[model samples]
Target: MNFLTDELDYEECDKEINKNDINYFRNIWLAYDDFWHKNKYDKSKYKYVKTAPRSPNTKYGKINDFYRRCYLILETNEYYYPLDNYIKIKKRKRTLTNLEHIIIKNSGNGKRQSDVQDIVKNAKFSKTYMTNVMKNAVIGVEKIKEKKILLPNEKLFVNMDDCFISSLFNNKKQKNRIRTISANKGTDLEKSTKSRNVLKDKKITYMKTKNGERIKRQELIDKIYDFLDLQFIYNKSSLVFIGDGAPWIKTSAKKENIPYVIDRHHAFKALKKGFIFNRKVDNKKLTNAYNLFINGKYYLLLDFLKVNNIDEKIYKYFKNNKEGIINQKENWNQGVCAESDVSHLVKSLKGYGAKIYNDKVLNNLLLINSARINKLNLLL
Candidate 1:
C-alpha cells in the first residue's frame, strides 16, 4: 500500500523537540500517528472501495444522485481522490480530464486503436475507451468547425475527389469503398509542384460512402452541397469547381448551377493517351495540338486530332468536357491537384495495410484526419 505522504524525519526534528518536555510530547505524537495510520489503512473503514467508476451514469435522472467512488489520474500517472470521504452519498460522476482525452486522441492519430493502446501507458483506458474518446473528440472538433466562419475571399476555388481504400469486409475478395475529400481552396500547380507544404493551408472536409451505389453517392453529393452552401453564405465570391471531369463531380456542379473546370493535368494526360498510338503525328504536331487546346481553339484542336487519326474516345472525352476545359488564354483556372490531396489526406487509413471494418470507425478516422489537416486543436 502506497501512502500519499512521506514519513516524518525524526532525526531532522530531534534538535527542536529536545528543548521542552520531549518524552511526554513524543509519546503523545506517536500514539496519535499509530491511531491515524490504522484508521487510514483499515479496509472496513470505507464502505465504497472502487478506485474509479466502471460505467458512469450519463443520463439525467433521480438515479444519478447516488454516490460514486472515483479517482482522478493526472498526466504524471499520479492519482488521488478529491473528496476525503470514501463513503459519502453524492451525485458526482467520474470522467476523464481534458488532457487525458487529448492524449488518447492524439496518440491514435495515423494509428490503430491497438497501436494507441501501446503508445499510451499507465492509463486505465482500454481499446473501447480509446475509440469512444476519438469519436467524441471528432464530434467536439466538428462542433467547433461548425461555429467557425471562413473569411470571404475574392475567389473561392472548390476541389472535390474520391479516394478508395481496401475494405475490411470480404478481405478474401478485396472490396473497396469511397472516401471523398473536398476543399474550399485549390492548390497552385506551379507552387505545389515546387513544394508540398502548399496544401497545409487548405481547409478540407471528408465523406465516406459506398463506391458504386447511386443513392449513397447522391447523399454524399447532397452533403457536399450543404457544406458549400454554408461556406458560400458569407461571401459573394466567384466560385469555381475543379476536378478530373468525373461524372459525379459534373453532376454535382450542374445540380448546384456552379461552373466546373476539368483539371489541365487530366486534360493533357487524356490527349497524350489518345495520341500514344499515332506515330504519324510527330512531336512538333503534338506540341501544336496542345497549343491549340491551351489557346481555346477547340474546333481547330478537334480537326487536328481527326486529321492525325487520334483515338475517337479521346475526341468524345474532350467533346463532352469541352465546357470544363480551362483556356489559359482566357480563363484563370490553373487546374486542381485533387488526386494528390486524396493521397495525402487518407494516407494513414490506406497505409500500413490498414483495413476499416465498419462505417462508424471509418467516418471517425476520416474526421480525425481532416481535423489534423486543418490544424484544429482537439484538446479543446
Candidate 2:
C-alpha cells in the first residue's frame, strides 16, 4: 500500500525485504500469528489468499498475485472456492473488419450514414448490407435520456421545433410525401449552461413519423410530457417551453398549464418575409404590418389585411399565436435551437438522395447519435 501510494523508498530497503516483498512476508507472519493464537488456524482461509511462491520475487510479482486473487473473488461472487477450481470466463468473440470499426467510428463522429459505406475498403459486402450493419450497430445500443441541473435554483429552458423528411425509397409514387420531424432540447437557466456549451451533455429528444394524417395538437402535447417523464425530467414551476409560435404549440402549452414564448428568430424572419410579400402602395401596408407585429397587435394586423384585400394567412397565423407572441417579454432569454439539433442528429438520415421511412431504425439511430454527441457510452 505504501508503494502504491508513492510513500515507499526502494534503495534504502534491505535485500531480503526487496526480494520477498511486504505482502509475502506479512502473509507468513499472519499464518504463524494465527496458529499460535488459535492453536489451529483455518486452512480454508489460506486457500483464498495466495500461497507463498517457491522462489522470492519483487513487489511487482506480488502485485500480480494480488490481482489474480481479486479476479477469483469477483468471478466466484465472493463465495469460497478452491484455488484449482476457479474458472476463467472467455470474452465474447467478434471478428470485426477494419471497415466495420470505421463505420461505427464515423457514426460516433457525426458522419453521414450514406457516406459511411464509401469508406469501406475491398468492397467485400454490398452497399445496402454495409448500411444495414452500421444502422444495426447504432440500434443495438440502448436508448439514452438523462438530464442534469448544474446550478442551484436554475430553471429549465425547453425548446421544440419541426422539420420534414421528403424522400423514401419505397414510397416513390408519393412524390410529396414528407415525415414530420419534431425535436426538443433543454438546459438550465444558468447562463453558462447554454446548448452549444453543453453539447456533450445536453437534454434532447425527437419524434418523427408520417401517416398522411394531420397530427393532432394533443398528440404533440402528450409526447412532450411523455419525453419528460421518460427522462425523469420534470419541474413544471421551473419549466418553460420555447416554440415557433405555432398554434398547436400554444394550445398545447395552455392545456398543460405551462408558460411558452415565441421564438424571436422565427418570428422576425416571418415578419420580414411576410411584409415584403404583402407589399402595398407607398409601403403603407408593409409599415403597418411591421408595426403591428412588433407591438404584438396581431388581431389588428389581421383586420388591416382583410380590409386591404390582402391574404390574411400571415396575419392570421400571428393572430392565432397572439398569446405566446405577446407574452414574449424583453427579459425572457430565448436559447432554444431545436432546428440545429435536427441538423446535427438527423443530418445523415435526411441527407440528399437518402430515403428513409422506417421509424424504428430512424428512432434507434437518433438515440445512438444523441448519446454519442453527449459523450455517453454509445453501446448504452
C-alpha lDDT score of every prediction, in listed order? 0.54, 0.49
Task: Please list the residue runs of candidate 2 whose C-alpha ends up more than 4 Å from where it truly belongs after superposition.
Answer: 1-101, 108-110, 113-126, 135-146, 150-153, 166-201, 213-219, 230-234, 277-311, 352-364, 373-375
User: Which lDDT tens digits does candidate 2 get at residues 160-213?
Assistant: 766665434453523222222232333333544433444222555666555465
Provide the clash count, candidate 2. Answer: 1
Flag clash pairs in model 1.
Answer: none
Could you tell me which residue pairs clash in candidate 2? 200-374
The per-residue C-alpha lDDT of model 1 at residue 110 equals 54
lDDT of 1 by residue, 73-103 (tens): 4333434433323212133434324323444
Off by over 4 Å in 1: 1-139, 145-153, 169-176, 179-181, 185-193, 196-201, 215-221, 229-237, 277-287, 326-329, 355-360
Considering summed lDDT, which 10 consecutive residues are worst modelled in model 1?
55-64
* Steric overlap count per candidate: 0, 1
Among these predictions, the greatest lDDT belongs to 1
